[model samples]
Target: MRDRIDEEITFRKLEVLLAFMETGNLSKAAEALNVSTVSVHRALHSLEQGVRCALFRHEGRNLKSTEAAQMLADVAQEVLTTMSDGIRATREAAGYSSDRLKIGSLYSLTIRAVPGIVIDIKVRRPTLQVELALGSNAELLDKLKRGAIDAALMALPDADPEIESIPLFEDDIFFAAPAGSPYANQEAVDLCDCRDETFVSLGEGFVTYRGFLEAFRVAGFTPNVTMRVGDIFSLMNLVSGGVGYTLLPGRVRGVFGDQVQFIPLKPQFLMRQTIGVSFLRARERDPNLLALMAVCRLRTRSVI
Candidate 1:
């Protein structure tokens, strides 16, 4: 009996019938299913014969559902949902959980914020394995949209109504120089003093670099950026080696310690990027995502 029912009502036939019902035209259904119109007509015919009822009737250019197709719509939707649930549960049971959380961040947080958050999450949930992927903000957003990542730690991304964001922390940018540099001894160095100095900077497209440009404009000079690197640690290395002074996030000082000195600018320019959690809003209620969110919030509170 079960085999008979399965033979009569299979997923492929249901797919065609569902498409026909939605579009109300044989050609439209064929287009949606990527099959020829004749194929759609044949599938619908086969479906009607299997169920022993006429499923549709002609109405001008449309194929309107006869009582049976209307009746099956609700059932088809339920079956599709059930199939989705079954697949998800099967993958979970098989331990095929993806280790594909591709988190992207600015260089400053990659070293300071990302490591601690990941460690704390691991300690709290050892079974949930994670793989960290890093890139600049624009690249990361593209990856997230392409389904290459589950979530990201991004500075304010461009306007996207589909994404959900939760601000983690705000950090100020600061001027830092080697400890003995003339500007380092001052309580607050005017940006003008650093005009002639070679500077180490994060490559453009970074939040730090953007803030640096704003501060430079305020100071009335296009400061020379002699060295541009993608990562903050490398940039710090240049700073500590006295390669040049740079504007960096305050969090950077936590890692470099006394190797470099952080100085306030005379005008005390405060530009911050809000590090936050971002993911597709449509994916909001996922259990694993919720667990990660809780971990992020807890870690953020501890930091505060």
Candidate 2:
């Protein structure tokens, strides 16, 4: 019996039942649903036949819902509501919503790069909804490849063949320390000078960590890392408290303000972080991605 009902019942019939329940008259129900009176009568008749139950009673020219009909109506309302929510969630997940734009970026860029691009995008597309996700370079790149994010602001060059990147600018890696530290006053600091200094470093998997390794290799020594922090701000805070020195991009100065100083690396030990926007090569023609790419180019052109 349950199988029979499942095979017979349909959303159109439930909608007709709901309309009939509200209007209590076949003609009025049909008018509300934009169907003919005969169509409404036939739909209600089919619904009762499908469930093998009496769902309505006639009083003169009007039809009234029975207890069984009211119960089914309640269940139908719930089903409709759940289906509506599910459809909306699916659309958001698929990135099919016209006004939505999902963006991924590194924590360090949020201090300045992300904000500038967001403001420019909002000005150009006032109704566009922006969603920002911050993560390490590897995580952001992964999200882009999987279509979880529309675009990413990260270091280049991503090895994924599907990822097409546009270079925004090259940011020089600098040695960061407390403002009163001895290295803060130097014109340029050699990485070897800090070889013995207990260092504060970003956790492995961060782009900065890779650059840190390269600088150490050039200096001919490994750092005696004292802490592995997850975010640049926290790493800077530790350095400010006289914890240890760290390596970071020049842009970090905006966040640390006067608390920290960034010194250039000596010519022989100089290393740069190439910052850029990345997206799936297939989404190159997507309007939202294009808009974001334009904003990034406009904002970084002057600074780079």
TM-score, each model? 0.66, 0.70
Worst 10-residue lDDT window, candidate 1: 92-101
Tens-digit per-residue lDDT, 1-304, candidate 1: 4646636667888888889888878888899999999988888888888888788788876667877788887788889889978887675443223433445565567766788877776776677777777767776787777767777886767669888888888877788898788876788878876778888888876767788899988888998888898877888899999998899877777677888999877765666767787877766776666767887898778663
> lDDT tens digits, residues 92-164, model 2?
5554446889999999898778888998999989999999998888888878878888898999854777888
CA shift of 65, model 2, Å: 20
TM-score, cand. 2 vs. native: 0.70
Q: Model 2: how far is 226 from its true place, Å?
A: 1.0
